[model samples]
Target: MGVIKVLTGNYSASEGAALCRPDLIAAYPITPQSSVVEYLAGKVHNGVLDSNLVQVESEHSAMSVVEGAAYAGGRVFTATSAQGLALMYEPYFRMATLRLPMVMAIATREMTSPETIWSGQQDAMSVRDAGWIQMFCDDNQEITDMVIQAYKIAEDEGVLIPVNVCYDGFYSSHLTTGVDLPLQEEVDAFLPPVHFNHATLDPDHPISLDPMTPGNLLMKYRRSHLEAMKRVPEVVDRIDKEFGDKFGRYYGGMISEYRIEDAEIVIITVGGMTGAGMDAVDAARENGIKAGLVKLRFTRPFPAARVAKALEGKKAFAVIDRSVCFGWSCGPMYMETKASLADAADQYCHFSAIGGLGGADISTDMIYSTIQKLEDNKETKTELETQWYITE
Candidate 1:
């Protein structure tokens, strides 16, 4: 068993990465995400953790340096948020395309123009299509454990893609809570030393890493990358199970459910606001509402089949998202959830609920109101308009 310590989400993430024993760490500090790498650097500089820590000029350089280190056969880690993530997009896309198995922590925050450094999912959501496996954490422990599991998932022979461990900026990032820090030996056993099938990085056997290719070949690479993504659901499930067996803490694989067995109405959520959603579910149940909650753990793969099964017999559902899908009036997760129920859109009553942008509060009352709205519209068949959780 590991020691239980009260740590903030950023410190938990740093400790998690250190437990895996990264070969190289590179990152440029940015709000919410800044303390994460700072914690790691402190360990390296204090002679407590043995690792090569590089202080880069910017998030772009941070990603580029780690990309090079990854190509040279090293297990690397980095993190950023908001604009930092925007800056890292160029090399970030390349990191996944090059099939580098690494983990980057995202202390998710709102984008600029309105100019805020507060909590929001927009930063991570903006880069969802950039070809990486992304997962969100509900708490500090999850932030720590997911980092360990992320490496296992990424380094799998069949799934050699990068991963993003995303959690809300001030909500989860700066929030302090008790986390059972995993023992080093146990983590070492759970995560094997990084290995690659290709001999490109090997000095004894040098070859082209990623040279210019014909459009036809580039198309092939794209397909191959997609095929690997299709395999991520199973990998995520298996790794979570394995982590559970070792640590005695199990998070239901792709999505976790709370009392959804015979629910007539359900509420779905992503990122840190899931707690509020669950509280709303409990409150609804007390008021004679058959309410249930489904937490969307993995967003990139969508887990459509699993979501379909979860919502199979439900009469209504509401997806609460912290980021907006400007293309539509609703949030991105709402749009995706609706798409998952494409054939049965008319079979159940549902709507998109957006809130928690720019550090806004997504209180239990807000979610329960959505649940109440779902109950009211449960008999209706078509999708309802988007609901924004605004408080005075």
Candidate 2:
């Protein structure tokens, strides 16, 4: 039987780590994500989790420690955000290309520019091509759940890629919430030990990792990474279903569709803004407008086919992005959604609304108003039809 407990974001993470039972927990203290490591530190100290909690001096060292741990056939876990993520860039990319299968949580925060520290998806977006499977969360519940499911997907034989389970820094990571913590027995049943047939530095069989090679071998190594990424959708779906069977909640897969069936227009969003976007969809329904919501839980190894299938016959759609693509005249989510719907029959309408960057509040009212804007724009039949949600 699975144990039950009420948890906050910090406790949720600690419980998640407990569930996975990693061999190493290496992390550096950064705001938001720091609580996760702190809670785990206590667990390590209390002897509840028999793991090495390495207090690395920097995020770079933190990732390096985990990579070394993972290479030694140890299940490794770590957490970070914004600048911390930027700091770990070098090893982070290598972890993906080498298919290390380490699971890390990123409390999403704004990257430096105007110089205010806050929550946003920019940090996650900045590393979209780092070859990791990225999962975004709409709330604390999803944050905890995704972290657990991420490990399963990452370690799957078909998809041996590292995963970043991301949530809004203050919104999900620091906020108080009622999370149902699962029992270790059930989690243990769900996730097996980190067994590697060919791990780095094993005495029985020694091998090389990230070794310098000529162009021919280098191309094959990169192709292997791409193949691993392509296997993510199936792995994610299977893991989510198994997790749902044990945990009683499901995110469908990488992309979750909300009320899109039989709807005329759909709003696409990723991250914490999804909850508000769904509420706005309900409001639009009350007004007899068939507007739906599609929240993308996973960004990298993007579900373009799923996105297209979800919005295949919809009359129009809007993408609500928290991070800008810049120079593309839209956000990353918007561009991806547009590309997905390019071959649709209904002439696939798209509106881009940017909001909630740098910890900015994205209220339900803002989302409701944006759907209203889409309704008006759809009716206007204007020559130019893209609009950005902004404040004067």
Candidate 3:
């Protein structure tokens, strides 16, 4: 059994991490995500959690500490947002390539240089290629559940990769909602003790880590990493089913499809804005437009096959992105989705709409308008130029 309680997304993530009973937690404080580590520290101070809480001087040091701890065969956790994540990029990349199984909570925020600390997915999207399994949650409950499932997915024997459970910074991180807190005993039963069969820094059996490799050997390592990544989708689906069976809740694995059955026009979205997109689809349906939505939960593996399947028969589709793709002149998700549907490019119309940067609100009406755009261009068989939703 589990208890229902109102909790902010940050607190929910902290609670979920605590429930997993990690051996160690290393993190530096940053906006939005600072409260997560703060809550965990309180738990450590109050004796609710027995894990060692390392308060490092900087985000870089924090990641370094966790890499060493994980290398020593301990299950570890960490949290950060925005600039903190940027600072930790060095160790962050190493954590994945070394194939260390760990979980991190990222309260996604916009990058600097207009110098703001609101909410955006740019921080996490910026690191999509860093070899970590990235997942986005639409709400606090999903945030809590995903944190627990993330450990299982990351520690799978076939996929020993780091996982980043990301949610919109202020949107999800600060929003309060009721969450079902699962029992510690239940969690323990669901997640077995982590067994590290890979290399470790044990004194008895010494090993060199991340040594310089020749081009051919490096290619082999890269190929091995890709093989492991290919195994992630299966592991993710299995864990989602297993977690649902035990905890009574499940998010559709990888990507979630909503109202797409007979839809002729669809809008794809990610993160907290998904709920609004679903509502927009419903409104569009009421107005006699066969509109639907696809919420992308996992971005690293980029559910290309699933996405293509969901939009297969649709007349037109649009991807709404909160972060831009810089040189691509559109959003990252838009470009990726287009690439995923490359084989079907001549079959239907496609468009990219970008907005919600720096914590801007993505209202239901905006989504409805996007669906209308798709509907208007339903018969066209060409990709449109990127549309900026909230032109300043």
Candidate 4:
């Protein structure tokens, strides 16, 4: 149905953005995120893509430029990672609160203090509540696919928040794999042009946009934003169905389950760790252990309902997070999953497992070990000590 090519995750991101026919692409080069804008710049220079390309000095200006474009009723895109994301935090927060419809790609990287330029999701997790729709990718193909889907999800009139399609830096970013790039025509048919305008700043049509407001009015806007976020899961489900019907791929909306029907134990995963998690589940099944897997596809809205439902009958579950949550002594996703099941906390045995920080490999062996731990304590019906996967 589409042309297949071996593309690095960054290129896949660029390819997906190009297919959407954005009006503008603004980004500054940074680590693994560099190639995303580079590829788009090349297409623009070669006249392959008819989009305005802005060469910015920093990630802040990059996001600021895209936000301006979106405010003008233009479908826009940008990409950044780690420190760059931190640099753009100001405008980034405003973009979502403004309810601008656009997509940004985050080549997820570890924040530095120990000083490292490597793959990790600490950057993305740090700003989870920044009001943007954030979803992490498990592989290169999902990275590409979600990029296109992001725009459709963002621009929906009911849910006009921006989206961050995040994938691990160095791991999925530099990792090249075969991707079926949808033809421009196919994408055009699937993703309609930007027809709805949030607020278009024009001299002819004057309209107030994001003026400083009193606390009472601001609270109303916040409530409206929260209500809109509650609609994202259902919007994603309807869109995934439409996407699957048009193309042959169906990624389960917020959470994807594997081998969970009759399993007694489940391994919860997010982002790039899902592949190894599934492998560990298979290995555990072969060893006569009933282990299944549930991949948390979208983390921004948190998908608490889908996650709680997935582990409904399971005896035990362990959430493996690539980024750690401070003060909690566990990963952020693991903390959130536990919060989601607060009412039924006594029903299942669960614990937190943190690993794969700063580009460390999350091997199948390490994941299988976690599954074994769950199997050993499936009958305990209480949370266990947090497990940290490390080579040493």
Candidate 5:
């Protein structure tokens, strides 16, 4: 039986990690993400979660500890935020390239420049190409569920890559909501013990791990890594169905479409903002506008095929990005979506709408307005300029 409990997103992640039974947890404190580790630490101290909780001095060291532990044949976990994630980028990439299956929860926050510690997808978006499989959650329930599913996805033999469960900082991280906590026995049945026949620091079978590689050998490793990433979508779909069959909750694999059927315009959104974007689509529908929404669940694999199929016959569409793409003059997600739909670019009118930066609220009105703009310019057949939903 599942337990119905009201919990914050951070707590939900902690609870999910506990149920997944990580053998080791190495984490350093950072805003928005600190509570997730803290809660796990508490569980460890109370004997509820029997795991090694390493109190590291910095986020970089924290990741390094997990990498070492994971290499030693232990299921490991960690949590981080914006700057913390950036600091750990070195080992973060190495962990993925090394083909270590581990789960990390990212309470996504804005990267510093003018310096702000608030909710933003900039943290995760910045490392989209770092070899880790990344998935964003729309709410606390999804956060909890995806954290559990992440372990399954990462440990799959065909896709032995690290998985990052990212949720908007201060938004999903701090927000409290009801979540259906799964039973421990059921979770254990769902996720078996992780077994990897790769390089390990086992004393019995000692061998070199990550030794210096020649260009030809390194290219082979890179090619194999790309091949593993290609298997993610199918594996994610299978696991999502299996989980939903047992838990009665199904998040559409890779991407989830809301009312795309019989729609002429669509709005693409990621993470927590998808809820508001869906509401705006509902409003547009009530007002006689055929608007739909595409919630991007996985961004790392890019979901190009799924995205293209969803927006296939739509007259116009706009991607809502919470993080900027620096020189692109659009959001990171917006650039990715545009690239994904490049083959079908001439089929629909498209534009980018960037907003919700530095934890700013992306109101429904702003989303609705974006939909309205797309509907208004459906026949323009010209690429529209980037729209910023911020007051000067």
Candidate 6:
């Protein structure tokens, strides 16, 4: 059975890893992400989790160790943050393209320039095209659950791609919250053991990995990776259904919609800020506004179809992103959402970007302001525009 406890988010992440029962864990500490490693370390030290806990010297070594373990036919896991993730970039990119099925928890923090260590999506965003299945989370519970689900999705036949389960630093990692820990038996039944076709150092089936590929062979591997990623949504839904049946918490596949039915305005968001956005929608509803929210938990394989369907008849939509696509006319999330809603242009669906970078606090007032802009546009505006919210 799953262990039940009032614990910090870091503990939940560790518990998730324990429940998955990884065969190997290699991690290096960085602020915000260190607690997750610490929790797993305790389990290893106490003999609760029988796994190879490698104390690597740096994030790069940490990822490299896990990559080696995974290539050796072992189920492996790891965690890191901003600079740590950046440091591990070389192996991370290869991990995904090679289809390693390794799972990682990345605590999102800002990239250093002026040298700050606060929370932001800049870390993960930096590797957007790294060929990994990235899933951003909204709360502690989701963080815990995604870790387990990520393993299942990555190891599935259709998608042997690595998965990145990302949650905000300090905001989701350090913050303590009440989260439901799934029953051990229930989770075990839902997730199966990792299967490896050909791994490095497998004496029984010795095979070369990342061999030099020339011409069409290189394109074929990239093609297969794309095909595998395409199957993530189906794999995700199947796992979520099983998770809900066992834990009573259903994360509606890649994106979860709240109060979109019979609504005219829909607010778009991803990660922890989504929770605040949903609450704001509820508050707006109490005042009789036809407002709703859609929290996108997954980003890598963007759910364009579902997004299009959700905004079919909506008059306006606003996408709140924690990261920006500076050269683009709007935030990355806004651009993705706008492209998804392209088919619904006949309904005059307007779009905008709000709140980004460095864990900026997003209040209900901010949500309300966006809704006001949408409602005000209901009567007069018909063109799409990218509006950035700046404090007066």
C-alpha local distance difference test of each model: 0.93, 0.82, 0.92, 0.92, 0.93, 0.84
Q: Ranking by lDDT, best first?
A: 5, 1, 4, 3, 6, 2
Please identify which of the two predictions, 1 or 6, would achieve the higher lDDT against the true structure: 1
Q: What does the lDDT read for residue 390 in candidate 3? A: 81
Clashing pairs in 1: none
Error of 1 at 38 (Å): 0.8
Off by over 4 Å in 2: 1-4, 203-208, 343-346, 379-389
Which consecutive 10 residues in model 3 have the weakest lDDT in total? 383-392
TM-score of each: 0.98, 0.95, 0.98, 0.98, 0.99, 0.95
Clashing pairs in 2: 3-183
What tens-digit string does per-residue lDDT give for candidate 5 at 1-392? 69999999999999999999999999999998999999999999999999999999999999999999999989999999999999999999999999999999999999997799998889999999999999999999999999999999999999999999999999899999899999999999999987888768988888888989999999999999999999999999999999999999999999999999999999999999999998999999999999999999999898999998998878998999999998999888888888988867877888999998888999999999999999999987667999999976
Tens-digit lDDT track for model 6 on 26-89? 9999987999989999999999999989998999999999998888879999999999999999
Ten residues in a row with the worst lDDT in model 6?
378-387
Of 5 and 6, the candidate ranking higher by lDDT: 5
**Candidate 6, backbone clash total:** 4
Q: For candidate 2, lDDT tens digit of each residue in 132-216? A: 9998887767777787888889888888899998888787777786777777777788888888776476667767766678999
* Ten contiguous residues with the weakest lDDT in model 4: 195-204
What tens digits encode model 1's per-residue C-alpha lDDT throughout 1-392?
Answer: 99999999999999999999999999999998999998999999999888899989999999999998889889999999999999999999999998899999999999986989899999999999999999999999999999999999999988999999999999899999999999999999999899887644667876777888999999999999999999999999999999999999999999999999989998999988998888889999999999999999999888888898999989999999999998889999988998998889679999999999988988999999999999999999768989998876
The sequence of per-residue lDDT tens digits that candidate 3 reaches over residues 176-198 is 98999999999999988889887
User: What lDDT does model 4 reach?
Assistant: 0.92
- Residue 33, model 6: lDDT of 91
Query: Candidate 3: which stretches are off by over 4 Å?
Result: 204-206
Task: Name the candidate, 4 or 5, with the larger lDDT value.
Answer: 5
The clash count of every prediction, one per candidate, is 0, 1, 0, 0, 0, 4
